[model samples]
Target: MNLNQLKYFLAIVKTGSFSNAADDMYISQSSMSKQIKALETELGVDLFKREHSKVYLTEIGAEFAKYAEMTIKQHNDMLLYLDEFATKKSNTIRFGSIPVVSSYGISAQIAQFTTNYKPDVNVVIDMHETNQQEVMKELFDGAIDIALIRTDYLDEVDVFDCIPYKKDIFVLVCNQNHPLSTKEAVSLNDLIKYPLSLLDTSSVIYTIVMKAFERHGIEKKTKCLTTRHKILMEILQTAPNISLLPLSLVDLTLFPHLCTVPLVEELTSDVALIKLKKRRLNKITKDFWIYWQKYFQMQ
Candidate 1:
């Protein structure tokens, strides 16, 4: 019913006991019990079922937990705003960028944000390893105010506004010693001739590269190597392996020995900035977006 009640319920569910929840929340067990009781009374249903001295959320309890989580997140964000920027002149915004986008000028944009809009706005950039779908989860859950992600990977959240960040490219990379490495570009013939070391095709890079390969009529041929991320530099560092990777994966610092050239064919990927529909983007997110645009222009 209230933020306190939701907090109590979540704590109980997490700690699995009233006494433990009270300890975690630093409240008296009786007070914790009263809050739970009041919540259960208001809902007119049992939220937790105790069995063998263990407590678990009942069917409705499980469902209400979701609502409680959303409510608590909203309340907490409000509290943060009140304490940090009571007058609302300057506000802090939190946002996220997948590692790939961060390399593509997202961080630089955020850094330069205050150069133009001085005072009252703080931007916090959180690095997350989420793909497009998980990016939606982070945004919708209010964990991040906005996000920079790959466009092709956007989840089914139709309400969010997506701004084009840049025209990024995905390329196939391998050791220079690789047989196909000497070729100016890859072809189905070139790919078929070699065993492929690849990242999980379900990953963002794979999806982007594979879709292009499919359109070009290249059959998917993979060899033994597989990884979640870092497939590019990993394969390159090792010998006789091939991987699909974003062009930026060849950063001099990250992959000191890596050399990048365009693949035989054109494979394009886009970076995008997205936010929840009709949501008020706090100063932080907006500043990041504005600077991101400028960064892209300079590039």
Candidate 2:
């Protein structure tokens, strides 16, 4: 019925579980179910069949899926074509960033570049804030000219040239009332006894945290899994559950009730400014990239 419903349908098909699809789409499971139900009602057909723990497509759902995928692809291609057309007509630099851009002072750097370095240049910085997956997707689709993303896709090193700006380390986050808050540092073994609220399984941080626990032979009792940091933090405060999050995302000033503790094992991800290596940049985008390169060297 709607684009979002179509996206949710595909997410359910890809993940094979309602909860997993909700995590992938960064929405509540109930909302996902309701939307899918609405979509089914509109079409007058069931799209999924559930057997115990897994979800499978119905016969008609398989046929609809092919059309749904084609529709989404066409929608994306249309946006990309529009972006390319707009780029030719205007002095705009389509800059994409993940949610935690402020944590790395990326916005401040951009401000300095525009205001201090090239105040006379009539360039518009069109900023897009999204998750890591979409950031990479838009960058590849040529919808966005440059992006600040995590170094999760190591295989794409040769495809894009990037400058590392921040080394984001993992830390334990909990409310002041938590038992672990008093500790300077905690180990993976220490976390086993407590209820844990972690990032979604689809997230890069979640994979790293799980691997750390596995490597240390620790079994984590994950009580909740979500992509929203605010929800994750609120859950920590409402219950005794704790979370492992990036050091930059743990803001003590914003959440005075919360405290962060270092992990005994080191887990880190680099936040970088990246652009396609072979793509020809417009004057504005080219200048912005060159300015950032010089800015990093000066640092």
Candidate 3:
């Protein structure tokens, strides 16, 4: 019935065990169990089925969990709103971005947004590893106001509204001394000559690249498949390998020894600003969304 009880319930569900949840919440197992028992008594339902070594949420518990999560989120948001009112500041806009968007130009845009909005508003940005599903979960949980993610990953079940912010073209990046560095445009066939180092298939850029190869019937193999951008860049620097990256992510200024060329076969991904469809935007978040739209339009 209380926020603490709800927290314990959610923790137990997430960690899948009372003891583990207790450890994560920095509480004793007995206290955690007592809280859950009290919660079950208040709700008049057995929330969990305790077995030998594991705990499973009862059917009713699973149904109650949805409401419990919403209640806790609303409670936290109310506290934040009151705190902002007391401080005489506009509401904070919590923004989330996948690594690709964060690296593209979101940081600079955020800086400009803060500068323009001044002391009236606060903007907080969290960079996430590229996982659209995780990002959508955070959005739904009210952890972030908006997310910058690739549109290709958006699914029907996400139930979020999105505005296309930018299109990032896939480019072949390599050491300046590499053979294809000076080429005006390289095809999938031309790229076969060099060993490829690619971001893992989970990345939208990788998907686009692979689909392009498949569409063109170009059979290719990668010398390296990594999830880390820095590691991929390191491989490019040390070896005569080419990697596909979004044009915006290829900062020649930072990697002066490397160069990027357009793919003869056009391949690109759309990055969008996504938010829960039913969530209302506050003044700060609204202003930020508008600013981002204008900024990208100008670009």
Candidate 4:
């Protein structure tokens, strides 16, 4: 049952001599002899029969020897396995932030984090299609480890440390060939007549755009086309539809034909690095925060 008992049995088997086994273990020959005696008594079996100074394993001893060697190997293997797993668990930092940060080549800065101890950390990017308020809510509820969301949204939600990452400009998008695209400066009234197909009602953009319409009392049948990026682009390019989306989604390389005229309005979101007020962050989390600061501050 005890490890010491099994260890002594194995040592004697390997050395084939009690004196040599005692020397290998750096213990007295008498201590080694006592351990073997204790094991033999507990198992109720004669482990070795000495004949003319030649030590040989008895039939029962040989059978128990197999179990003893296996037990000792398993004990050592378990310690090695735990050491490896502990390193992995410690290096794994469960953090999640929105694409609002990851989309802007912030991943490059995140990729630069290096630790002398672990050196590698796994940062989980949680880019969901929910509103900024909802994203912050998740961070508050411990659903997400960390979140990159508009700071304004967190005003109502109960939260903690918020590092101001950067500021993002709100851009109005329309088809390159659409009528509004040619205008010098389109007003909110100009977009009212056209059936507006903006971001989904669940998106952060939707919340901001709805507030403007409500403030102005602009009455129109706004089409909330909650579709994928590809589908939304198709609808915007083909029909007289206007929408406001994150500037990051506009890939000039892919959608060069799309026309983007600034809204000429004071509509901007303060992107922030946010985490819960109560939960404690580990070393990996701290390292990521450091990378984030450099990422937003750099050229």
Candidate 5:
């Protein structure tokens, strides 16, 4: 019925007597007999037949003995499996990032780390990209071990410890034939005149752009708000609507019709590696954080 009871039953079968089994198991004979009695009561069958001075398994007890040994073996195997799973999980670093990691060469930086660092053992790095807000959320919730995110929201969260990596400039993106596309630089005033294609409210750029406009007492017009870069590009290529995007995300070759115009105000945001201050990291994640900290300082 239970592992301990099963173990006791098998011990008696192996030693051929309850008294000898109790001695091998370091339990009193009465306790061992009581356990076997309880197991037999639960199963509604006698497991042992007693002769003058020896014990033998009943027909039903021999069959149950095989299952009892198998159950113990399976329980031990499960324990081993869980232990191995925990070890592998600890060895893997769950890294979260904003969508522009590849655009800004951060992915290359990570690749360099994996190749150059001489860890005692091979460490697995699992990384994924999401919007900035979600990256921050996952880091705080312990869903991710570390994150690459914009510093826009970092200042507001007191619990974060971050290493500043690089500054990315914001630019105006529009189709080549759009009115502002020919301008060398555009201003907030020049931008508000045309309908804007803004990122979803969850994005760091949206938060910063909206704040910048509100601070300047400008009410901007919106053509569409989206979370997908492809959708934003499609809208930009077909319409006069313009979007403010990080310089790293603007690939002129990929979208030949889209051209980037510098912002006259020179708005910029810092990208950084961040982790929750109170969260205790495993050895691999801790080494990753420390390595990047020193790496950024040298840069």
Candidate 6:
């Protein structure tokens, strides 16, 4: 009927006498007898036959004893499995970031944080190209433990604890053979003269570049609008058009013929680490958060 009752039944069968089994289990014979009786009543079968001073198991009792042993083993194994799962969950930290921050340095910082701070903990990093609002949503929904995101698109600051990690300058990138590449610096007016390749209007980079153009009262001459950097790079390779991008995302080594020049009008955005204000962080996440705070402070 229950685990303890089944255990008493098994003991009676193993020891071959109820009194001896009760003594081995440290319970009174009367109590042990009552439990075995209750188990038999629940199963509608007699488990033992009693002689003058000894007991012998009935045919059904021997069969049920094996199942009782198996059940207890399975129960203990499940408890052990759950214990291990809880330990692993506490030691793992899930980190998320935008592509720019992941490409710049956060990936390496995560490796260093694990090696220097909590070497025993596990760190999982996820990178996506979604905007700041979606990153905030992931933090709110407990999808990620921490996120590195841009501050430019953040409309509400009260929901999260934000720490500025790096500042990225928005620059104009062009192929080395392009006419703008010959100049040391180029103005927004100069950029309008050539056909432009721009990020999608939904992107923060597009908003910043357009605002700079609006201030100078110049219409943007866009030849192509794309969200993919590979396509933008391909466009710049064949066409004499330039596109705006964050300095962090521009790897001059990868695109050997590409050159980045500072915009005449200063445009920049802060990349920050953010987490929910009230959410409790696990030990690994908290340790990495402190490491990053101290790391940026030294810089």
lDDT of 4 at 176: 87
Q: Per-residue lDDT for 128-174 in model 4, tens only?
A: 43455456545533445567666654553464677787677767688
Off by over 4 Å in 2: 1-89
User: In model 3, which regions exceed 4 Å deviation?
Assistant: 1-90, 101-103, 118-133, 294-299
User: Residue 219: error of model 4 in Å?
Assistant: 2.2
Query: Candidate 4, which ten residues in sequence have the lowest lDDT sum?
Result: 115-124
Preferred candidate (lDDT higher): 3 or 6: 3
* TM-score for all models, in order of appearance: 0.63, 0.69, 0.67, 0.61, 0.67, 0.66
Cα lDDT tens digits, model 5, 231-257, are 788789989888988887787777899
Tens-digit lDDT string for candidate 6 (107-128): 6877786677655655554445
List of clashing residue pairs for candidate 1: 90-120, 185-264, 186-264
Stretches of model 4 off by over 4 angstroms after superposition: 1-85, 99-102, 114-134, 156-158, 227-231, 297-299
- Residue-level error in angstroms, candidate 5, position 53: 80
Model 2 per-residue lDDT tens digits across residues 1-299: 88889989998887799998897677999999999999999999999998998999999999999999888767765654465467443467889987776766888888877776556656678896876777876775567879888786455488889987778889999989888989989988888888888878757777778888888888776789987676687777768888999988877777778889999989887789998776666677788998989888998
The best candidate in terms of TM-score: 2
Please give the TM-score that candidate 4 achieves against the real structure. Answer: 0.61
Q: Candidate 5, which segments miss by more than 4 Å at Cα?
A: 1-85
lDDT for predicted candidate 4 compared with the true structure:
0.65
Error of 3 at 136 (Å): 2.8
Deviation from truth (RMSD, Å), model 3: 6.1
TM-score of 5: 0.67
Candidate 3 residue lDDT tens string, 190-249: 987788888887677677788888899888888899876777887787689999888888
The predictions' CA RMSDs to the true structure, in order, are 8.3, 7.2, 6.1, 22.3, 19.3, 21.8
Whole-model lDDT values for every prediction: 0.67, 0.82, 0.78, 0.65, 0.81, 0.75
Candidate 6: worst-modelled 10 consecutive residues by lDDT = 75-84
lDDT of 2: 0.82
lDDT of model 4 at residue 8? 68
